[model samples]
Target: MRPGDIKILLVDDEASILQFLELGLRNEGYQVMTASDGLTAVNLVREFHHHIAILDVMMPGMDGFEVCSMIKKMAHTSVIMLTARDEIDDRVKGLKLGADDYVVKPFSFQELLARIEARLRNQFPHLLNEVTIGPFRINDQRKEILFNDSMLSLSNTEYDLLRYLVINHGIVLSKSKILDEVWGYDFGGQENVVEVYVSTLRDKLEDDDHVLIRTIRGAGYRIDLP
Candidate 1:
């Protein structure tokens, strides 16, 4: 999706920082929402579906790490932690807590925008243009998947996994392969994440008697298209 089509959430307790970043991002054609604190950020998360979130590490009531964990559980929103601390431990902590990227204070707006674009491109690769598999259709430009002409309310992660499976249709993809492709190469998460997402997709796409995605026993999962 284009920058104009993507929604971003900016959360910082510092009013000046929030306004500066929000104004810069908005000028670049991104739909930007700003929150002054972690609590307000959480409330905004519930209200709107954000594709990316720029969260400040130091916030009252709830910290960035806590907020990141909460948002990750709710949706597939990619997170970038903003902190003045340049300590290695702090950066590692944010990554461990599921933040896609971290930026230190005093960074340029151009740098931040570059990072945002990089993360988005990584999530939605260039190869994901459009693919049709039987009754299912994937349109990456629109960031949507259609099943029998109806749109599927899929999370970002769900859409990526489903699109990957359809691209490699009829091939049994191992969990490790899927993890690298869908969750990224350096995703230090459990393999069961793939299983959980696959199960979710099956529930949404499969019928009681028909299975679009098949488990290949010791192999992996495959979507057999006619």
Candidate 2:
């Protein structure tokens, strides 16, 4: 998906910041929603499904950390916490609380926009219908994977990795390629995450009935359909 195709929620008690982000992001072709406080942002999230959110740490009523926790609990929505605090503890706390990323206040709009784009790319990797490979089927739209007519439970990362492989069935994809395509640049060379999620997918998809994901020895992995 492109920058403009994503829907974003921007929350800040500061009217100026809210307006600035709304205008800048909208000009870049994104569907933007703005809330002046944390509670309103939570309500907006409940009312509509946003692709990503830019939240201010300081807000009236509720704080951004609380809102971030609420958002993370509901779905795999990407959130970037915005704060003027430069303290390392605050950043770590936000991360521990489930914020996808964090940005210091006085940050450049270009940087924030870049981070938002990267987050959206990671969250929604494809826009294709349910794809079938051998006995396995992946419903990208519903975020589900099915094997031999039985539904398989998969984590968010597992679903994305599986879908990426299935979409390119029969084609070998290197670890770097999988990381670049599935995790996005924001993942920062954490390629071991690919292996972890692949292991999870294997446990769910590989059994007596199906074995679609195949490792390529020293190369990478692929989805084999036969």
**C-alpha lDDT score of every prediction, in listed order:** 0.85, 0.80
Prediction 2 TM-score vs. true: 0.58
Give each model's clash number: 0, 1
The numbered model that scores best in lDDT is 1
lDDT of 2 by residue, 1-226 (tens): 4555668899999999889999998899888889998888888887778888889998878999999999889766899999999989989889999988888989999999767755654466563344555677777678898888999888787777877787677789999999988888667867777787888777776633335677787889978877
Models, CA RMSD each:
11.7, 11.8
Q: How far is candidate 2 from the true structure (C-alpha RMSD, Å)?
A: 11.8
Candidate 2 wrong stretches, greater than 4 Å:
127-226
* TM-scores of the models, in the order given: 0.58, 0.58
Model 1 segments beyond 4 Å from truth?
125-226
